[model samples]
Target: MKEDYAFITEQGESTVHELSTVEALIKYQEQFHTGFPLTDKEAEMILGYMEGHDYVLGEVQGNFYQGDLAEVRERICWEEYSMDDVIDAVCEWNYELVLEAEAQRNNPEDFVDFAKSQSRYERLKAEEATLD
Candidate 1:
């Protein structure tokens, strides 16, 4: 089953995690600058659920896992990699995606203006005006 994990960074950024077992989670927490909010006992219970899984070696404090958005996205859905790798990959993937999303969000007026210039939006506007 796909485990839905969540990582909340010190900056109040929250991202969804897709790791399978507790061991993977521990491994991931060990590598990253951010620590898991879970206690050791809780982490152990998670480890119990993950009996056999493979993990990729990733440095927690470095950008080794950065910019490989495609690979990261694929790893999130993969079962072969341990939960830590999955979380690391997914977090890295989302870091980039979030940047892009934030950029787009900050420029909504640009999209709105672009949409207004499109014939589709013009047509819709005219239709809506007529309904008034």
Candidate 2:
């Protein structure tokens, strides 16, 4: 599952706001001017780029599963992993996604292999489990 976040500032204070992925995408386009009517691949790339950053905008942050990691683990019955492990996994996964997106963006002939990406992500999780 994918999650989205935005940063909103009011009265000299900033807070992270969780929103649906579609809403986040729209906000992203509005802020970045990447263009309207983004294609699926383009949207994926934008999400990847967004998640790769610590702050999407001033005082606003973006990261995969930023505030919902615990719920996500519980929903998926990932009882064996610690919160820190989950955080690491999410960070690594986002980094990999961003790298893949950048690579594909730079090389038009190159295509993203979701199967490979999933396999690698699972392997990372397995490795993290074994480290415990």
Candidate 3:
């Protein structure tokens, strides 16, 4: 029989229904807008990372693994690359995507305009660095 799972929130709340697959988890995230908010791409990226690292679907920190929920949580706590690390990586990836989209939106035709856009992009990066 397939094991059931649930998407738990950082605040200790969980989804109303038990999810059965990676696809269901993604759908819950997209439809409910509860728990840690994630875009479709971000969710897929994080899930992929978990799977690549041998974590079962919904076995990360913010999830419930049926009867093994406590054990799963304990194991995750000791993991070298925990869910937080994956989340940070995803956030960084999304930020880069945003920056690229912004650059494309401001696409400049002439050399002078290209120089100006480059200068603006640099300035934005510096400001973002300061904020960090």
Candidate 4:
């Protein structure tokens, strides 16, 4: 039974966005499933919601998630939250993506080598083109 939390982020030395419960954010996020579930429009809507625009699940298209949209809206309609509450909700909502991104970050040496190789290859290609 987590309380509603504000979806606040930096905005001209302040914060914005309304308050919502973790339950609602989880429900909204659940609408966009894995395995290529969301349509481009639907995916954009979810991204918009993440970027602080208030959009309910029913307001968008896509038959991906199976649940009561009314309940989701009800939870979203809440308007009271602390910063910690908001952080918890947002963190939970984005945990999987964060993990996925972190998983792709452990190859700095390989990336550097690959980049150097690519630069040399491009330079060689340019030199060959000039010889033509």
Candidate 5:
């Protein structure tokens, strides 16, 4: 039987937002259905697992997930990340955008070229104007 993991937010609270087994985690990842930034404890659980084993990322708002650890580390070196940063930058913006912009990759048509061209920082700034 596969071990099931639960994301327990707010520390001692008994509520679990999402739960999945190791096998299911990998399956969810392949399907792009996982979430991101994992709660503090969730990160610990992920680290406890052996490498190469499948794990699913917990999702929020249909974007951002555990797969972005590298990018998140890079951003954290500078300063704290805001919610908008997580949504637009980590989730919507990606390094692959550069490849697509350079014509080295292909993406779905609804994904706007101009929008993906902006860096996460730039996109956050532009979004501020829209919110005003």
Candidate 6:
């Protein structure tokens, strides 16, 4: 039988969590800055369930895992590399994507600096929208 897991949020709401381990759960919860507001004993129990088919508080069957995470890459140190290198990295990461196009279209001279903070795909979307 498949082990079941759930995340009870601070708002008295619960959701399915397929990644059973507390470490992965913690990482998942932390992604939204929505740390589980559980007691130490409850937290330990959640972690304990990682062993095998175990139970905690909430469990709902036939439910998809509610904690899918987006890729969130951090910004690289601008001072660590020369202007040329950063642009190269950004272009390589973008791969003819909108970041390269937007940067080139709006700020070619400072394209490296412009793309510096916009590392993740989600952030790139926001940056592009704001640029318009």
Q: Lowest summed lDDT over 10 consecutive residues: which window, candidate 3? A: 74-83
Q: How many residue pairs clash in each candidate?
A: 3, 0, 0, 0, 6, 0
lDDT of 3: 0.49
lDDT value, residue 6 of candidate 6: 34
For model 1, the run of ten residues with the poorest summed lDDT: 60-69
- Model 1 CA deviation exceeding 4 Å by range: 1-79, 110-132
lDDT, residue 54, candidate 6: 27
Q: Which stretches of candidate 5 lie over 4 Å from their true place?
A: 1-5, 16-82, 105-132
Error of 6 at 105 (Å): 76
Per-residue C-alpha lDDT of model 4 across residues 80-107, encoded as one tens digit per residue: 3322333344345445444434444433
TM-score of each: 0.26, 0.26, 0.31, 0.23, 0.22, 0.21
RMSD of each: 16.8, 14.0, 11.4, 17.1, 13.9, 18.3
List runs of model 2 lying over 4 Å from the truth. Answer: 1-78, 109-132
lDDT of 6 by residue, 32-99 (tens): 44433433433344334222222222222322232212222331111112223322433344344555
lDDT of 3 at 14: 47
Q: What's the CA error at residue 17 for candidate 5, in Å?
A: 3.6
Best by lDDT: 3
Q: Which of candidates 2 and 4 is the stronger one according to lDDT?
A: 2
Candidate 1 lDDT score at position 26? 56
User: Which residue pairs clash within candidate 2?
Assistant: none
Query: What does candidate 5's lDDT look like per residue over 5-32, in tens digits?
Result: 2333344422121323444434444455
C-alpha RMSD between model 5 and the true structure: 13.9
